[model samples]
Target: MSQRQRLWQRLTEAGIAPGCHQALLDTGRLQPNTLKLSHWVQAETALWLDGQLLPSVPPRRYWAYHKPVGIDCNVRPDDPQSIAALLQQLPPGVFAVGRLDKDSCGLLLLSNDGPFAQRLLHPTQQHQKTYRVDVDKTVTETMLQQLRLGMRYQAGASWIEARPCLATLSAPNQLELTLTEGKNRQIRYMCKQLGLKVTLLQRTHIGQLYLPALSAGQLLELQPQQVILAAQQP
Candidate 1:
């Protein structure tokens, strides 16, 4: 194994959230004076924080869950209908990377590694999210072109353009759309603006990771590499 890597990179690779690691260093708990960014992480090297030797990073966990409708992505302990309440078996520390509204259902990635989540969800990354949508009426070519080119929406005091990388009529009343941005209910909003009613909105892919053949409300643990690889795909 290559033994040369920056401290932050090592921490991220070890499944430590970059922000969390920096917090410890900033608080004088990580002994920044003794450690340098150029320091290498080795099997025999010990990491100390707050005078206590830190253990090797815990094994990273990743899961692809088929979020069922009615399950809120950001689950609060007080919300009985949240994903946390519906799926009580998720390992502690794991959280949904992004969100699926209470009415939408499909693939949702969960992970304990904050850096990994950041990489996938950061707006700058522009990871693609694909959805299969069913509308109340037949979608026209003009509407598809409008979606592909872009559409404007009111944002408080301003208007913002929302565009899809790919939009096609999967069926007379169904559409397959891929987007790189995550705005608030973007797909639904886009459809509403186009004078269409969305009857069903299901996310089928996030980057290259697809919703496996799992039943609604089901969870499947995946190797961390699977997600990383998917995000790297075109």
Candidate 2:
């Protein structure tokens, strides 16, 4: 095996998937982006196969999971219910992109490919993630308008922009909010700033990936088209 293939084998053993390696290579190519047949893994493929290398995955795989409220996004080597524990039986190397606190539930994306995961999680991509929040108090039109207008907040002696939250569902005491920035406990913090409390939180979408009809704790592999669309962004 070539040195590159040898390194790739080690990566797989270390829980990195092949598709991610392909993504890195794709990113390094010049314009008129075209992947040659040699890009495909072959028994005789050399380390210098492309004359240039990148950390990537060929056809990145994406998964949509219905995460339950009780499970943490992290793997607990000891907890069988953690996302990692659950994936152990299906395949190796899959990992969650962004995180959802243990108390929140809804759609989540996972992949064995590292480059794809990096793009989705990177701050520059600005991929919008939406959530459905149920709060303890009724919302006022003025409050909704404020949320929509980007409220100001104090973050330890510094001011920060609070992006507008688009409401998708509403009840006297419950609401679904769409957010762009994935700040830690941002929805809860925003509601608290407005004198409201969150009774429940669920993230329903990530870019074009939706929670769909999957019940909590179930996972579905993303279709090829879905992956392409997600990468392009709307």
Candidate 3:
């Protein structure tokens, strides 16, 4: 989408009240700023609104949130457990990265920076996400090897396509599984395919970033610089 198109869609989604959008176009309210200068527009452009200039995108923010079970990943205003309400004290447009299912819980990265998220999430990056899972059946060597072999399983209409992960017996009926892919409930689907029912699932790591001393619903901001530096170290 062009810078102009993106701005129009943003305003439309924000629910322009008692006004025609043509007024915005005619009145010079759409400020493209540096959006025209680059293919990636970060911290550069936003629609000028009201009587004054709406601020350009805020400085990027990154937070590692310990998301609890039952919270939806999206920022649905009506859902109490929506991430928007969960992180309401934070600035707007901050959204969760590395989504966890409503039943899954653990280290969910939240950031206002889209490019940074894309850097980590694009399938080719192969960033590792570690999950601790409790299962109803024994976690055996056979199961581990199958997952290591990247067993292809069909989950309903979609395929659970993931890179082979190292699955080890962490404890009886439990496994520590790490994957470079973040498919929806991929671990649970893997467990089910192996005849194990997932009793609990929690992500503990994303790349080099980890949750530290955070309780459920707690948000701890990280210095974006340090996070990138940490990823480069070792």
TM-score, one value per model? 0.76, 0.71, 0.79
Give the whole-model CA lDDT for all candidates, comma-separated.
Answer: 0.77, 0.68, 0.70
Candidate 1 segments whose C-alpha is farther than 4 A from its true place? 1-56, 86-88, 155-158
Best by lDDT: 1
Two-way lDDT contest, 1 vs 2, winner: 1
Model 3, global lDDT: 0.70
- Which scores better on TM-score, 1 or 3? 3
Of models 2 and 3, which has the larger lDDT?
A: 3
lDDT of 3 by residue, 60-114 (tens): 6688888899999976777887876865666665666658999988888877665
Off by over 4 Å in 3: 1-39, 42-52, 224-226, 229-234
Off by over 4 Å in 2: 1-59, 153-160, 232-234
Clashes of 3: 0
Model 3 weakest 10-residue run by lDDT = 34-43
Question: Model 1, range 44-155, lDDT digits (tens) per residue?
Answer: 4666766877555455678889998988877676788887674346544566889998899999988766567777888888888999999999999999988988889665
Error of 2 at 208 (Å): 2.1
